[model samples]
Target: MATTKKYTAILLLLVILGCQKQDTVDNFPIMGNLPMGEYQVGFQTLFTYDLTKNAIPYSDWDGNLYQSPTSENGRQYQINIWYPAQPDSGTRLKYADYINLMGRQTNFGESEEQKTFARQTFITQTRNLKNIRDTENKEELNTEQLNQLLDLDIFARLDAQPAEGQYPVVIYPNGSSPAYQSITCEFLASHGYVTVAFAPKGRFSSGMEISTTGLEVAVDDLEFVLGKVSEKSNADMNQVSILANAISSSVGAAAVSRNEKFKAFISLEGGFISAFEQRLLNGSSFYKPENIQTPILFIYSPHPSIDPKYTSHLKYADRYYAHFPKISEFAMLNYGMFDEFIPDIIGAHSGNTKKGFETANELILRFLNQTIKGESGELFDDSFMSSRNQIDTTFVLPSLPKPPNMAVLKDTFWKEGFDAIETIYQQLKSEGNPQPFSMNFYTEYRDWLAWKKDEDYVYRSRLYDLAYDSYPKSARINYYAGYFSMKREMNEKAKRFYRQALSLCESDEDLSASEKSTLRTYASEDLNSLLK
Candidate 1:
């Protein structure tokens, strides 16, 4: 009789399991969804250009610039964006859409074509957090989540007209990961902030390969992204922040240090590496500014590379943490905290982990809200950690007790960067290289200097003249001249330059097709603006 009862109980359990509906093939549980914030999330892709900057030559592990012949000459980046959505707005995006898109990307393991179906299911499972209370769910996602488990449905309907006005945006510039990891972004969009990520140029996506183009190209594209996003009617450019994880953290940190558009930053387990690791491993062209003004929160794990290494010149990662007083917080995850079993396979460095991603998400949400929206100590003042988290720290320069009330990084190293470019031009001139550079940082330096309200334009003016003289027949120079003249209110001079630039655009032999098209369009715009 007892044996009969046991079999009957087993049958009942099996029946209950069989009755549950599975939203995805990977068996992620059904969820109770709520809006990521008071508002639902919306998404759209934005494309913009850096009329002033040109693309650099891209290299691979096998080739250098000229030899490989692959270059990001036109430097077009497509930004995947998520903002607050309307209650009943456009079409909802599926995790499967991103999965299908990113699954075919190159770096997504062996023979992406063979793994597409399984890969899609795996990605979908990572996001179905409501059924599984891991990855740090502050509360259950309500069943009302609509198409998404949360709110960031791709190209989904959002409150295009939000009752609450505009919202802040977080830029996740150039991550090595394909933009398909919508789950990482959905978490942020769920919390009322517009989160943006770029489809990596070279690695995963079959777009313009910018991976070999180096960090400078990655950093410059950020301004163009910022420019286009600000053009959106719904986005609040005034309260923007930048965030990144792992190797891409360096890109975000380096960019935020230079551009004033970012008011806050979040570095998830990446930014700091010792000087030795910087040179030997990561390449040293990151975080050049000795001091950064924007407040940053560094959520990290112990990298065996940087802090505490005798050669890195940093005793602790906190040394790199030393920037603004009371504005920076450093939280350290235990060594190999993310080095667990399955995550190790996906990407140990990826911030999206079932064990810790939710906690990381919570920390980021509170930190962004407090630093960006609040007036006082909203971040770090309160305990913002999970039991798995072990340490929280902060540092400040002894000289600057408070961030100096100055005009957005008074003395940028860009002037020096131009000097280096000048040296390159002379060498290129000797080598008979017709095109010396793809972009000029000289204009930006001048603008940055002016932002400081400086009287000395003489230095950069001479440098610009040198670049023009070297690349005289260059269409890029003509466009630069037109832009420079326009800024100085020399409309007639600008028109002449724009016309010349348009003519030259057709003849720039070294330019890629995309570059030529971009130039023609920009020159026409310059002329049209003058006519208006």
Candidate 2:
């Protein structure tokens, strides 16, 4: 009887599990999608690149770029793929390879020394975070939070079909995390380029655990993969390029410099000269910048917090830009004021240069269209250049509306005040930071520091009303009002604010999926609840 009961319970559990509905794999999320775009995909083979030439490059087994051809009998290599398939519709594609780290084979039962060296990769160390709770007592991602390990590729786009000759390929070396490879690969594939993502052999998924011949392997694998991609006939092999982010930028620059076939190079948040300097700081980069000859472009962050070493005299971009005048374009992104990443003092001191952080696709499009497509037009105009500069100066600057005087404040003090109190009517505009109080110390008196006076009762009803009145064109302020109304349990008011925010806002990249989903869900739930 006891055995029968246990069997019965196990049977029930199996039935329940079998009956549960799973998430529809076919309806996977395609991230970084712009509203106005066109794409129709189909299923195809996952063409993998080969990298056997870079097996052993570093002789001393220390953490450094290995020269594959000389040190190794030939070269060590690996492969990356761009499969033609629907996003989130099925199982992810996985490949197999041998990964060597610090002269240790990482396949299994590898040497203890190699294992220890592999563990020293910075990315793995940074991703180990202790859990912390938030104001809601819920787990909040803090500074030490493993943003890199947050399953970023959950609904990510995997690959895109490229036009038919071996296509010229471009590879991007990610910063800090191996996850960067996925992000860049997806972008390049979408733009009709074959992207060979590099990982240390045997370290395919674990990007940080670079093999003993990591750099040499990267170069050799890149060449091998380019050949394979070219074999497809649809690929253009002659115009291959390389892109690197942060630390990899240096490696990419050096590798491409030695290999003339690599026509162009791009550095996202990195520069060759300073790369060596930074390597020196971290006790690496044994080679000098002058050894590289690749033409490079750099994309930089505007926030001070993002680039803490801005105050340090290691301005790598400027220095390298001066040296490689013909082969480099040092364009920076510009962030508006009130951003929380970098503080004001450091941003100001660093001259707030290089501010544009365009979406991955947009950046790639601009780069490829300019270099490979060879088209020069008004797209890269001076206005765009100026905007990039403006963003750099104020990336972390908050958004705050300023009023003329108390009388004006009475009628309209805060920028989005009227919109906050009533229905959405017009689009909001913005010139600078929305949180004026955050601009500097003693900002608490900002309210009392009003410049204008209004007879209207702006301050009586709610904060949003006053904010809307003062900065009528500030969409962020309007969004805040909506956000606050939702918090106050004012569903109708919240809906109005959110709708106003959505209607008024022009860009979508800054808004996260959770935030946008919140507005839609709240609006629907509140409507249904009220009806019931």
Candidate 3:
């Protein structure tokens, strides 16, 4: 009897070992259709947009939208969706920065910066590379060369999921900017629509590539892409919309004009303004905005009047309002103070841009949700004046903010805190029984800093409790504790301890993805080991 019992235990242990080995191979995560999250689809990887092969000009005719002379080329563009991948897929996506838009050829970012450096380095010896003829090519790289100079990558987020059933589709043609497609695509996706960022024909195969020969060509491309999506089993044929930005705005309008299937049209900083007008305030392709059978949504920056290049788009809005009496929704948003690009600052300031981008995106989501799903309420009132009036005030914010300066401060904080933790880590490597407090302390400090900038109570509370339990030695333990205590409505305790904790805590973690992944790996390994 004793021998049998001992053998049974050994057999059971062997079986457990076998199961552990199996788990590693079964790493592909089983994802259920939960509330939408980021997902990178395989179809997005099939092709790429190569702007280098078909260079399109990006010159801002003064602040007006610049059309590449090569815009007349046949459609052959590429776009990649940067979305949330299903967790446990064991796949890491390789993101192509803006340089990828121009095929795999040149590094536009470096070339642009070098242009200035070259000017400074040689002064008169060499004009900017733009003027210098290529010795090997024996020709001045004109429109196509300059067109490839400015490119941005497209990243699809998990938020880009289409709602169940055949839903309407929207094609967001990026104007003046490459990354804008993801922003608009994600926004429409959140509202249960199948949105595609069409890489213009000049770009990679993954994205929609349309000719810039005014609105008619854009409309044709929209129709072409929609037809392609409609062929898919998941696409809904009944309802559809097209949203465009900058130059694409005309494209969206033109598309709806010819295709009755398009239920609505939205223009972000877009209008019937003709690209051909000597000045920016030209009339759009649609003469009577009210006659536009489709409902239109216009999202504009509130202070375009101050922006030299965007100033003319404001007049287009006036023309739109004059023509389309009661059938439009307008959202004019203040992007924020940091977006101020004063001279030398150029594109450096983004606080306002981000704020506006997010707001515009959310508004687009709400608009699509109500219009496509046929959800009715005061929210759908098209006659509502001003963009701010149409916002959905009920939805809670989804993510926490990592402030603009967070990146700059990361090294400093990590040196002070992470270095100390590394020391403890090394000691543990030698079999020292160090408490698992460092990870917790780092998480709390990072979250607290996030809370300070964005005031997200949930993130702040979770981090605080984690720190309190994991690293009591942490200098800011009390701050986190006090924060949550008050957040949980523990007013007295919060008031009593917040000041004390805040005073003691040093700088916090920036909460980089690498750090989070490390923590996750450790936890997962431990959980697996314990199960054994």
Candidate 4:
């Protein structure tokens, strides 16, 4: 009886201690107060319209289109800027203040009723993301706990006086939440960067679409924001870089490919690393990986399914891949979870969310300093990362092969005839090297041959045959094949090619509407001619 009483007493004490520890941890700031840098952080919200493009009617979260009372002439943008600021004695903004800004984002000059509705919708939608951590585990937070999150204090001051200096700009394309990556933005601002982010919307709706057109819309929005940032007196537009997170990394990749103004690109848990995103990017005309001449940094959590070797495709740029063993992609964002929330709620592998968040910010800052600020240092050396057991870094330098002189192909074709072209193609194929020429190269060369078809029907026919063999599914190439076959008086071959072109047009979604129409019209015409 004495031993039983002693065991019960020990169990009771352990329970009491565990409860006390839980309560103490719960008292800490929900977002795990990240350490601030040298400068004070100043934040402001600006609303502007891009007159170059027309604003399309947008749909709400429930797929209902919003009918606005006032007339909208062009694309509406709400720019949230966090910049280095002069220290002030005023009270800094709370997290709630930032949350409240989401209400006025789309309806800045609208009625109070609209703003109120938007605010409530924003709050409700945010609260609904309890299962954002993973599919299996859902972390439920009651009203009181959520209120604690809103009441938490953050570092950014509202409309504080700007510091007098030209600072490099960092453009962040936000994810689902308007306040997404707010902690990282403030941290960067405190370190003397003009970090800006905006809510990304699709061309015709508030919700972003997953198609190629949607990707273009996001890129256009980024470009519009960049143009506005250039107007700021303190912004050094020459040193602008994009710090893209999650799905926005696709937009960043497309932006960096087209625009030479972006000095560097950083991907935080980038979506492009996945195979699905890779196919989506390759489908877009703007995704020219070869054009990315600036440095890039990819910060992502290591996952068993993701192979880091695929990232070597961006051969024109110096790339750095940093894998964090401690955190998942979702934990990288500030979602108002407690410091121990990720590890306790998610799993042991998730690690300490607070430490992971701080480390990610430090890595981003250090990389930006080296690439954009041109600061000389061994900040990214393996030794620096070796000290941090959680991080694994790989540096990939540019490996550009000398492009085959495509001009030689045209010269050889004119001098040595069609047989010479076939010989070169066969040799290149036998060597198992297709990098020298792309599908576009073949298409352009085939078109040029068609233009000079008056010289010899055999030349155009032979080239079309090669192109069709190379790109069997290309509707454009197939249509041309039919046209050239008809010119050679091969009516049966012409009909087959036309039918195949139409079949591909029906099956392939990558072709544009105009291209499809042209192929259909021309292929039909050729088919009808052969049938008659």
Best by TM-score: 4
Q: Across residues 1-532, which tens digit of lDDT does each residue of candidate 4 receive?
A: 9999999999999999877522121243543545556887788877888787767554665667776642376777889888988887234667766666665555566456654665566455544443444446444445565466567777777888889989999999874444557888888998889999887788776667777777888898889888888888879998999988777888888899889899989988888677667777788877766667788888888765455565676765778888887777656777424435433333234466667777788888999989888888865676667656667555555544423445787888778876887887767666654443455666667667768444557777777787777778878778878888888888899889999999999666657788788778888887987888
TM-score of each: 0.49, 0.40, 0.41, 0.70
> Each candidate's lDDT (Cα)?
0.50, 0.40, 0.41, 0.73
lDDT (tens digit, per residue) of candidate 3 on 1-532:
9999999999999999877422111231111111232333322421222333454443221232233233333334443332223323333221223223332111223344534432222222112221322233223324432233222122232223422355466666653123325434533443455666653322322222333344444455456656666665556678777777555675665555445687766676564343332122123333222223555555543332312232232211211211121111121111121123111111222223433444555556656666677767544345532543323222111111111122433543445643443444345434523233334334545654574543646545554554565455443465556656665666666654554443333333423356445434543443343345
Model 3 lDDT, residue 93, Cα: 23
Tens digit of per-residue lDDT, candidate 2, span 156-182 = 233433333244567654322223344
TM-score of 2: 0.40
| Candidate number with the higher TM-score (2 or 4) | 4
Off by over 4 Å in 3: 1-74, 79-90, 94-99, 102-165, 175-178, 200-213, 271-291, 302-351, 380-532
Instruction: For residues 277-341, write the lDDT of model 1, one tens digit per residue.
Output: 24422333344343345666656554445452321321111222311111111211211221232
Give the per-residue Cα lDDT of candidate 3 at 167: 49
Off by over 4 Å in 4: 1-35, 54-71, 89-91, 109-129, 132-140, 302-306, 336-349, 392-397, 401-532
- As for candidate 4, its clashing pairs are none
In candidate 2, clashing pairs total: 76
